[model samples]
Target: MPHSPDDFAPYAHTSLPRLLTTAHLLSGAPGDHREPTELVRRTLVRVCARWRRIPRDDVDFYVRRFLVKEYLRGSRGRARRAKAQRAVLVLLHWEGLREAEIAQLLGWSAGAVRSRARRGLAVHGDDAEHLRGLFAKAATGLVPLDVQLDAVEQRGRALRRRRRGAVAAVCALLLVPGIVFGGNRFMTGGSTDGSGGGAADVAQSPTRIVAPGERVDAVPGAQVWLTTDGKHWSTPEAPNQFLGLTDASAEDTYRNKYQDKYKDGYGSGRKVSVESGKPTVSVQPDPLNNTSYFLSGLYRGLSADPARVEVTVDDHRITGTVLTLAGSPGWGVWYARAPLSPEELKASSVDGGPTVTVYDAAGKAVARGGAAE
Candidate 1:
């Protein structure tokens, strides 16, 4: 049995195998099980740690539902591997290992192993028959299981080599046009040299000017700042900057230095009001889990009064509620609570970074954040 949240807290790190086994049992297979288990475990830990703030009922539902959705989405790729698995099944059976032993070795339950074997036998009847004969011969001291396994491995390698060659041929074919176009451009010196010489160069040069205070062209959506002296640079700030508390203890030191530099209503005077009449929404994104989401903002807005606010991270709307806090004018901060699927977190936009967007109840844009390397 799985431990309760409190009992499991200390053992969270060590219970990974149990979590994996639970996920496998629930999903009927361990397909992509390792990653999902880790994600769920981390989400549970965070949720349990903040149990006082999160609604227990919602947390329970969210955890299970999120896992199911992610598992289903992940299984699409596994469907393609069914053919390869059929071949593996024949090879495994020919090694004289019983079905139970195969189940244990593969980390699958007995029922799943039996189901896979039956389905595999149906799909590869001839292969199974041939393999069975080979196994019988081996049992009678006529051949060896290791030799059969070796032959299977060799055939698999040959298939892979053929696939690789085909892919190379396709890539070469696609590169032909690009190669010709580049060659033509290089020979004609058409915009190839930085110095403009062609008739078109004069037309383009005037449009591109390097000027003082001009922003440099950076990767799209990147945040860059410039200082006049080129000595120290800071992160680009919005018109009304709200400095993040990197180290809460250092707040006083920063306030002392810059507090008097700006006007009386400069820093803390710009208030982000969470009106009682307006609904409050919060969002949080967990780096550990691939999930980023929002919560309670919509419901709060509806219950209190009709209002519009948009939350955004890097200009993308969060999909679900991850965290919520309570207080007047919403003195709480929400985070992306649902774990991100591994693939979602790993995926990058054309600019090669994660883009996040948040919107308020009125579908207006609020916050945007992104990371790139």
Candidate 2:
């Protein structure tokens, strides 16, 4: 497959800033120890090498998608999985790709893609402020524009040498009749199961959370939040674990969502508050019953024990208590479990899992999170 110089040149030169912006945000910093230019140079090299296979229209979009997707995956055995859901959302709403296009790119259903994007936006709050912060920072990095350009050019030349060496090796291998044809070309196309083009941990699983409990508005430690969809229900599982509800559609969506943000039910740990450490919030399927996701993570800092925690699903506030497994506080994990009413599911999906307020033993509003910050 061959591409004209005209096609390769524009995609290489024009797409660099967009690619750099995405790379900067996802990688926290672009390129290597001595040079950050490698990120841009290698991406351009890969896009050019695979130019023939990639469709021409929206070529820049495809390249940007590939750059972020592959860069998030990194090169070693352990891939970077943090904030993957946000990255995918950035590709969808931020990058302006439609639901159908995202589905085509990631091998997901249009409905499912829409569903996940909605959920992602709900958690992270889709807004221009985040983007403003992103590009604002991108402007400052990579000083001395001439030197940066020179570094990119130098890396591009080095990449060409490596690619040529690879081609020669392939040619030599072809000379032997019995050798298997496993082409390890630097170029690759998108994968259907989302392993190739989407941002996710390839081996990620779904996380589970309990619905808001009785006697309490939201459990003292509401680990995860679920929209008010009644297609789900609760059931018992382990001594201290929550395997309460299950939904097949959510199961599929969770698999597609990637990365386990709230696998362990929220507030399962000893630390009730965090001064420095950012704990993980995953949504995983219940291993015991293949049903619901448990608590995700701390949405706000709370007192030693909030007698009651309030959760807002769809805009309606639901009060839940710190439910102890089998009425034993020794279970040590308090959770808020609320399943949305049918009428509310749609709205909850758009606005789920945000804490309304936490109450002390005397039932007073604990001012924190949201606009308070």
Candidate 3:
């Protein structure tokens, strides 16, 4: 029942770009010469081992999905996790996956998928029409196909070298006297945080979500435990404060983005809203103490208290966490307390830079607005 290298030949030949592209994204090295290869090298080992289990119905689907998951496995933090999800969405969409289909595969509703993709690709909207363009091109322009293939092969060599190095390390460890335990930990990639993923582990530091419109430093009785400007600190509470984790108004963000679209009949018959709501973005508290803060916003002109709302800003997409049912009668509210920082917002705030967009539960465009400066 063991599968052979022959079983993976097809994937290498046809999906090389996707594999390389995903590796590049996950590694955060779109231009790196070696990271992509290392990722491909590692992924191929998994694929070959599991070849027999890969579905016969759509080999490409399973293969590509597997690649993304493998990359995510090595990634660190919730922010990185969200980034990985966004990259996967854009990459898969770039690879011709249908909006609804991608949504289902990723555990997202069809509507959420559309909204995420639209915002992620808002900068690439023009080029997206040409489906035949390679996925790598979307991120790094057209990398030569041969170059991609070369990286895949290079990974094998690097992995073999790593194995030999690991063995040498183990041999050295045996000769050392009192350092055995410490050496073993190092070899296994153990870390001080205990998760090996890094400092962002939620177990070590839980987020203190400020309520919408509440200043981070102004949390009642909470002194400055964290700070970006060095002068200001969130609560000194280890489990309570973190910086710039997104605070949004589910309703305001929606209204600011879509109010104008609806009135102009952007997708009139299909229910597109251009109505401007001018949603206010803030870092606020989650009374439940679950996340950093609800990135909450109140928006006007929602279509039928949408079952879901998707908010995309900067490089992150947040699905509504708490919804206020028509609090202002005709207003729709949505919010998510993200772990992102205030510095992170500056990247999305430049003119013609990234903008925030909101979508209805059905994947229809509700509204969009520029990121606050």
Candidate 4:
């Protein structure tokens, strides 16, 4: 299974623009050409040298990891203050990856990823549109692909010669804890499903929300806006816990332990199929009080375009707040709060216990999610 420059060229062409934008952002200077360009070039060289040995399925992710490390190793001054925050935001929004996916990439726990990401979001979440604009602008400034391709081949050969084909050391440097996303690579502006296409059509499911409750709306209803306001992240019931949600795909949502598998209408650690177009929900219990819960997740794949997210707990339904970046194709974060009596709380599972549903603008139920035996 040997690979040559010709074999690797196509991938490099498709990935270079994104790799350049990531480098520019991580450098804390989206408009600057010096740091980001060099970072991408060097990382590309490393990938090119190991092209034959690196698994084909992971080439994109491997490139991203190398870019992050190279950035961290070289970061300094003002750029260091919010490095984690910036990195987390980039991966979540720009890359469309879930918290767990990012955790794997960064060698951190999912909880750690959430905590730092909340902090970062508190600072720049409201400016999502502006940030995206910056990324798009940066993509235009990348070094010419042909010039970089030449550099990659030449530098890759030199690196291989110096190391004498010792890939073990290189592999060790690249090793980081997390689940491998088999046959997936970094894709910009589309779904990362293995089908090599856009997001799948939303499918119907048995999941349902209680009727005759407050209708879902687009206005922000959460206690605190993680993307805007900087305060109110913590409640008396759950000190310092972020009460906002980030967008996660159906797969990422169900994979979480708290929401995985259902038994007798509850998430009970059994396998379940989370169909496309059906919304996926995760609940975070308030640590100090057993009465309140925070619900959040994604609704991007529905057959009908999603207009709102509705949550039903103990027959009480509430309109969930939605966060969508400008220019995005109807995909963003949906969150709601459920305060239940201790008895009611104890009766439900922590993560997938509530009934969450998504509706189109015409108020049709486009997709459904939550525990159902």
Q: In terms of TM-score, which candidate is strongest?
A: 4
lDDT digits (tens) for residues 1-373 of candidate 2: 2355456665566666666655555555544322235555566666655555454434664566556556555444323333455555766745767665554444334566677667666654666466545546554564422124444445555666788899999988776653443232213432223223222212122212333221111222222222221112122331222221222243334333332433222212122233333221122222222322233222223333444444454444444333332322211123334554323332333333333344444444443222112
Q: What is the lDDT of residue 174 in candidate 3?
A: 82
lDDT for each residue of candidate 1 in 1-373, tens digit (9 for 90 to 100): 2224353344433444433443443333334445545445444434344333333323333333233333334444667356334423533564444654444333334456677777766754747776566444433421111112233334434555676799999999989987976675545543312233533321111111222122222211111112111101112221111122122222233334445432231122111223454433322122222243211111222232211222233334333222122121222222222333434433432343333333333333344333321
Candidate-wise lDDT, in order: 0.34, 0.41, 0.44, 0.54
* Per-residue lDDT over 109-134 for candidate 3, one digit per residue giving the tens place of the 0 to 100 score: 44566676666565556356553254
TM-scores for every predicted model: 0.19, 0.36, 0.33, 0.42
| Each candidate's clash count | 32, 46, 53, 1
State the local distance difference test value for candidate 3: 0.44
Scanning candidate 1 in windows of ten residues, the lowest lDDT window is: 224-233
Residue 358 displacement (Å), model 3? 41
lDDT of 4: 0.54
C-alpha displacement of 317 in model 3, angstroms?
48
**TM-score of model 3 (CA atoms):** 0.33
Q: Tell me the lDDT of model 2 at 118.
A: 71
User: Which of candidates 3 and 4 is the stronger one according to TM-score?
Assistant: 4
Ranking by lDDT: 4, 3, 2, 1
lDDT of 4 by residue, 169-208 (tens): 6675555321254223322233211123322222212222
